[model samples]
Target: MQQLTVKEINTLVNGEVVGEYTGTITGLERIDKAGVGELTFIGNLKFSKKWDTSEASVAIVYEGIKIDPGAGKAFIKVKNPDLAMAQVLEVYLPDSPHFETDIHPTAVIDESARVGKGCRIGANTYVGKGVILGEGVTLYPNVSVFDHTSIGDHTTVWSGTVIRERSEIGKHCIFHANVSIGADGFGYRPSEQGLTKIPHIGHVVIGNHVEIGANSCVDRGKFSATVLGDGCKIDNLVQIGHNSVLGRFCIMAGNSGLAGSVTLGDGVVIGGSASIKDHTTIHSGATVGAGSGVMNDVGPGKTVVGYPACDSRDMLKQWVALRKLGKS
Candidate 1:
């Protein structure tokens, strides 16, 4: 990242400096681990202990937070510091251009397939029979699009990602490297003999603008569609199991695992390494904190954190009391 001055940050994000300060910040990071020349945030007062140790030149903080005067860190006060920081950071990204549209010679496109004009199929990609790919779809090297699958316009599927048969992917959806959509779920039936595999006949249906991260798996349903609603942002290594339905604009962080038949309402967010049980429902705007083990349904707009996932407020209170108990 290029160095940005304090004045440049204020201009980019429309923020004001709370204290008299001027310096060049090289990058953005969290307060607990920011290095020299990096600008970080102090959203939670709990992280105050790490402020003194932070090598950051400046910290973006909200009004009314008291830091140690000895720390000597310049502060940027805003109505919402985090949002301002994010806005300033957005300008540093590279622009994507539209130029080429052509399939590679090595790509094996089935004669029975129906592909839209101007689609680009990369090397070693296999578009199976009866597959319907909309216009401007770009498949990276080695992407396997199975039979009867339908992908909407302008979707980009990265290398090694496999779309199983009969899946329905929406427009502008990006499946990053090694993403596996509409794969068979782990379903078995107990019989008098041995375990019998239950065939998954249902598909995975994704809505528009949904972006799936690298190496993630969204399994095919047993009978009905496993749906990912519009604009759901899933992170790397996340797993959405069979028959699950995620609502619009849901955000799931890395390594979050949702069991089969689970349902998430709109704007739900599951933190990193969180595990949600099968058949449980998460209501709209709910948040599950990092490492949470959710066994029961979550209420709308509530924040849950901890093992067996209790309310975030109750968990924080218990954690504070427990620490004091240990000290006593």
Candidate 2:
């Protein structure tokens, strides 16, 4: 068991300690569930109010909060308790899966592929012709990299991910299980023979530090690449349609989707299950609320809510007015 003193934990987060605690912390847990020898955190007033009832011997609290570290308890105060907790949790993190060998015997690499040094290819993985994998790349079991795809150094692709032909992945990116990159877009037109599907000849370009969750899909474009900029984070079951362009640090929560040709500027956040209309542009720092159906462009730093989304303030006022009418 790894043990850390209250003082040691405080040093890790650069926090101000409230009590002279000499107890050792053995683990971290939720505030309400924490016990003796365990540490917890409070980021808001709701959690801070639980301190008296919580069993934790130590805690990390937001700075400037009115928290009392009763008799035996200690509090480490920081600017952001959530971030500090994350840094502390790293000490308790377990090891991830790794291959015993650099290249597993069951894995297949095409003769024309260029795999850099220190790459770890897990069992049953396939690297197709002209594939380029930079150093320290890890392709977990059952991963499929198609022809001409390039993955940069230190990128880790989890099991069952499929990178179709011509895809480009950048350094230090993580792709969770079952992710589909460079898939055909849903493009069809009415024709004499009913419906004709448009050919998707382009690919996907993901920038450095991007992290895509499990089962997400990034569709290939009709003529150009579908791009995800550096530090973009996509949640599980999200969908990025063909030719969609996302700028740096964009975040799409679970089940959120962008229709074809959508453009999102830096720091845009799409809430869970929200859908952006085709050809729509969301400027930098805008946020779309959960379950919203966006049909028009959103300005920078604006927040939209409701079904057929409008400005958050306007939507709240509308809700209040509706409630008043119901009572009238």
Candidate 3:
């Protein structure tokens, strides 16, 4: 673990020292779990009472917050203690893995594939014909890049991931283990010959800084490309159907799904296990709460919750009314 002096930490978080104490912070932990040589933060007022009992040598708190004088712990006061804690955690976390610029012996790259300088293709990975990988790209074990696919510079595709044909992935993107990009959309036509699959002739386009979590699936469009805008984050087991477009900085939590042709505006947040119906539009800054089922468009900055997704306040009112009626 890395260690930083209390003074150095104060500098990192742009914080001011409140008491005279010089100690090294070796780790970051919750207030209840933090020990000596660790740094903890009191982001909520409820946690303030535990400060004196905490074993942490250094504590980050909001400016003007009252502290127990007898605590005897070093204090760093910041404008936003929670944000400061996040920044401090980033400084303490381990660096990402690095690989040599050599393709593994078991890896196969088609003659027509174009791989740029400083790339690392790991064991059993396959690069199909006409694939283009930019400089410093890393494809871990068992990754598959289908024909005509293009991956931009410094992208990392982890093990068991598949990038289907004709997909375009932008720079600095991360596709975690078992992620499937450009997969066939779930479309079918009912006919005499049984339900015939609607062949997905399109691809997937992922913008820069996108990070897709493990086991997520982004289906290819029926005619055009399913688009993921810059800085969009997709959590594990999420499903993005064909022709879905996610705007910049949108966040989809674990197990959330967007049906075909859905559109999400910038900074939209979808909570865990939420489901959006096909062709619905969710405007910028909107939020869908956990387990919600959205069947219509959501306006900008609105927060919706519950099964058929209504405004969060409306949902809460309904729940309260039901509880009162039941008691009566």
Candidate 4:
């Protein structure tokens, strides 16, 4: 078990300790559940007010919040308590599996593939012809890199992930288990033969520091690449359609989906279960609330909610009216 003194923890987060105490914190837990020898955090004023109820020996709190730490307890005040807690958690993060910087005997690498120095190709993994893997890339067991794909340095592809032909992935990106990249887009047209499938010739382009959760799918484009910009984070079970372009630092929560050609500007946040229609453009910093079905463009920094999503304020007014009608 890892333990740190209150003074040591305060130094780690550059926090000012209030109500001096010299107790050791063994672990971290939720504020409500934290007990003696445990550390907790109060991110907001409400949580700060509730500090008295928490049995934690030490807590990280926002700098300006005034809260009384009971006898023998201490509060470490930092600029942002939530971020401070994350820093502390990073210290406690367990070690991940170590790749041996060598290819497994069961792995298959084509003669035309180019693998960089210090790469690790796991058991039963396949590196197709003309694939270029940069230095320090790690492909876990059962991963497939199709022909003509290029993955940048230090990228890690977990088990069961498939990167189709011509896909381009940048450095330091992480693809969780079972993620599917570059599958053909869902495009069909009515024809004499009932329906004709539109062949997808394009691929996927993922930028640096991007993380895609397990079971998420990024479909191939019709003519151009489906793009995920730098630092984008996608949650589990999400679907990104063909030719969709996500700007830098965009975040899509679990179960959210985008139809074909949807464009999201930088810092856009799509809540869990939200759905965006085809050809819609959401500008920078826009937020789509959970369960919203977006049908039109959303301006920068705006928040929209409800089915057939509208401005949050307008949706709130409509909801109030509907509630009054129900009462009447």
Top candidate (TM-score): 2
List, residue by residue over 161-250, the lDDT tens digit for candidate 2: 999999999999999999999999999999999999999999999999999999999999989999999999999999999999999999
lDDT of 3: 0.93
lDDT rank order? 2, 4, 3, 1
Q: In what order do the candidates fall by TM-score, top score first?
A: 2, 3, 4, 1
Q: Estimate the TM-score of every prediction.
A: 0.76, 0.97, 0.93, 0.93
lDDT of 4 by residue, 91-183 (tens): 877676776648999999999999999999999999999999999999999999999999999999999999999999999999999999999
| Residue range 1-328, candidate 1, lDDT tens digits | 5678777777776666655445687778787678877888776678666788888877777666776424345777677877876776686554543424488888999999998987889889999999999998989889999999999999999999999999999999999999999999889899978899999989999999999999999999999999999999999999999999999999999999999999999999999999999999999999999999999999999999999899999999999999999999
For model 2, the run of ten residues with the poorest summed lDDT: 91-100
- CA-lDDT, candidates in order: 0.88, 0.95, 0.93, 0.94
Sliding window of 10 residues with minimal summed lDDT for model 3: 64-73
Residue range with the least summed lDDT across 10 consecutive positions in model 4: 92-101
User: Model 4: runs farther than 4 Å from truth?
Assistant: 21-23, 46-55
Could you list the CA RMSD of all candidates, in the order they appear?
Answer: 4.8, 1.3, 1.9, 1.9
